[model samples]
Target chain A: MNVFVIGLGLIGGSMALDIKTSNKEANIVGFDANEAHMEEAVSIGFIDRKGTLEDAKEADVVIVSIPVNVSLEVIPKVLDIVKDDTLVFDVGSTKANICTALENHPKRRNFLAAHPIAGTEFSGPKAAIRGLYTGKTNIVCEVEKTAFKLQERGFKIFNDLGMRIRYMDPKAHDKHIAYVSHLSHISSFMLGKTVIEKEKNERDIFDMAGSGFESTVRLAKSSPAMWSPIFEQNKENVIETLEEYIANLQKFKELMQQDDYNAIYKEMADTNRIKEILKGISIKTS
Target chain B: MNVFVIGLGLIGGSMALDIKTSNKEANIVGFDANEAHMEEAVSIGFIDRKGTLEDAKEADVVIVSIPVNVSLEVIPKVLDIVKDDTLVFDVGSTKANICTALENHPKRRNFLAAHPIAGTEFSGPKAAIRGLYTGKTNIVCEVEKTAFKLQERGFKIFNDLGMRIRYMDPKAHDKHIAYVSHLSHISSFMLGKTVIEKEKNERDIFDMAGSGFESTVRLAKSSPAMWSPIFEQNKENVIETLEEYIANLQKFKELMQQDDYNAIYKEMADTNRIKEILKGISIKTS
Candidate 1:
């Protein structure tokens, strides 16, 4: 199979590499809106060659991984060009917008809307890592909308990369992701902003910071170009999640202000249940 | 030297183990108000023996590793009981309260107020791991107040553990820690709470969650027995820092609601400076 990957950043570049490992004969080509990333992906050996949108149309499998905003504009065009038997899918964070955009298109059945629940804060071709999808979850949205043969190819491709698939409606996928994934990035970004704005001594942060601070702010280093449009595309759900998050912070703050030690302890103790919920999300180490 | 460790949890227990590694002859005695913790410390070989508070009086070095609120109440009493030559110190998160408690004691010069900027969400004797402090930052507050000879022992102990020491005033240490460490915990705990409350499908969370969510909410599992007291002791600084953090979230949320993608993008791009600041807070891998 020839796998063509669009947007040669962390997701696309990594998937291209893993797909080749799964099937050595599979030729992987890449394209990115950024000229430098296209060159970097090829140089990094993540792809067999740099391909164009036209080249992507002829491929056996097409994986689109651009920012959510750009994905809305580009996925349908890819569908318009791809062969009928070819399977084209997206690895974007949000699903509703992409699903809606291609809902009534002539080649709608040729596209599978997927959100590969994997990635690091770092981005671009250089940030691509091997086995990133191993033991990670992949949510396939609106699977019933896709052709059966294309869906079968997706199942085999994702499984070869060691992923667990869960199916959901596009609207449900977007709503749940707002609370679980996208909001986490925003919270972390705001945390880094809050610390930088409040503390003048970068030296103090470096000196007094520990594992807790590092993990909490790690997501703040994510690519702004990739995330800003995600927030824009999932505007309503992201805003709703932020409102609850901010309200929870304010309530906890008031409890602190009143020196309500019991309440404060209860708040953290209750939230500790996250330990159980988190056990289900596993990262495989080689 | 005979070292007495009061409160044999993750901090004291790990420190005891590392001290033993540093010098095999170091006679480390353990004391915890909780009987099970003391028994576990002895069984795990983190300490040479499980001793009492009274037994702690004659040791050449005393390391206090209790919650900050208890540190305020117990540190002064420890200072009253210990011999003049004893080098007493603490590994609490907040420093101002601990420093103030021992400020008027005759053995004020015997105590070194220290906060080792290291640890995981887990606590207690079983959670103790060797070399937890190696390549970690150790912030010592009011170093000038410690007797010259005892301070020498501190320099050696921290150095043997492979920790880099940074000097700080107690007041400044508490204030700086609020923004860098305490705020991060609160933000994480509340993030976990908000998600659990809003998203009823724990299965969806397990499916869609990524590294971003895992890292952001990891600190939610931290012990309330430890953090509540730290928050209570450093109430003013924490409250002030939370105010700024909340305000920043409000501004970011408004930008999202307004669909001001450029402003949101700029907000994250500006905070990306954390990537550089974080490079300085390196974790030593053995």
Candidate 2:
């Protein structure tokens, strides 16, 4: 298979690497508008060659893994250029916008809207790793809209990559992801911003940061390019989640201010049920 | 030297294991209010034997690694029971309350206030591991109030365990930690709560929980017994930090609702400075 992946950053570069590693017959090519990333991806052996959208005509599969905003603009362009047999898919976090953008395209049948629910805070080609999607969930929206053959090809690829597939409507995918994914990035980024603003001394942040701060603020390091459009695309859901999150924090703050230790304990204890919830979904670390 | 650890959970048990591994001459004893933890600590060889408050007086060093509220209640009692020359210290996250509680104790000079800024999300004796505090910062607050000889001993033990020590006033420690440490926990817990409330389906959460969610929500699993008092002790500071955090989130939400993509992008881009701030902290992980 000849695979051409756009935006050779963390997710796309990782997919290319994993595909090549797992399938010896696969010929993986990459492209990035950022020259440094393209060079790094090539040097790191993440791809066999640098390619352009023109090359999509020859590729068996074309992946749009750029930021959501860019993907909305780029997906139709790729669909217009790629061969009818080419299975074009996007691994974007927000689905409704991307799906909406290509809904009227003549080659829409060739496009599969997918979100591989796997990523790290780190970005760029250097952050790419093999098996990033392994054992992770991949949400595919409006699969029936894609040609049956193309949907089958996507299934084969995700299965080969060791990911479980879940089907959801594009609207539901956007709403649920806003709460589970997009809101997390915003909370972490804002937390990092608040702390940095209040504590001007970077040394103090570094010295006093325990595992708690590191864990909670880890998403603050995510690419702004990738996340900004997600919040914009899913603005309503993001706003709802943010309001609830703020309200929750305010409630806890009020409890603390009143010295209602018992209430604070009860609130935290209630939320601690997340241990079981997370364990239910958690990938085995061992 | 004989070392008695008052609490046999993750921190105390891990410390006992590290001390035993590092100092072959140190005989370690542990006691916990929870019998199950005490048994697991002994079974895991975190302690050579189960000891009591009476044994605290016989030890050359006494480590009180309990919940913050329990630490406040127990430190004075432990100080009253320990030998005049015994170096007593509690490794709680908050320092001001514990330090103040023991301020007038007859053995106050023997009690050293320390907060070792290291931990994983896992808790209890089963979570114990060797070298948990290795190369981590051990912040010693109000050390001038400690006897010079006991302070010398406390510094020696931490140094031998591969920890760096920094001194600050207890009040300053509480305020700084509220921002860097306590606030992170509340943010994570609320993040978990918000997501769980939105996505009632635990399977979706597990499927969609990328590394970003895992990192941001990691501290949600922390013990309520442990965190409740830290919030109670540092109530004012925590409330102030939460207000700032909620305000930041609200502002970002407004931008998102207004569809101000550029402002959203700029906000996240500015907060990306946390990448540089985190660099200065001693994160053992790459």
- What's the CA error at residue A19 for candidate 1, in Å? 1.1
Interface RMSD of each: 1.3, 1.5
C-alpha RMSD of each candidate structure in angstroms:
1.6, 2.0
Compute the lDDT of residue B145 as modeled in candidate 2.
91
lDDT of 1 by residue, A121-223 (tens): 8999999998998988789998999999999999999999998888988888888899988889988998899888765754555567777888999999999
Reported per model, the fraction of native interface contacts reproduced equals: 0.88, 0.81
Chain B TM-score list for all models: 0.96, 0.96
Minimal lDDT window, size 10, model 1 chain A: A277-286
Candidate 2's residue-wise lDDT over B13-51, tens digit each?
Answer: 888888887789999988899888888888888799987
Clash totals, every prediction: 0, 0
Q: Evaluate residue B191 in candidate 2 and report its C-alpha lDDT on the 0 to 100 scale.
A: 90
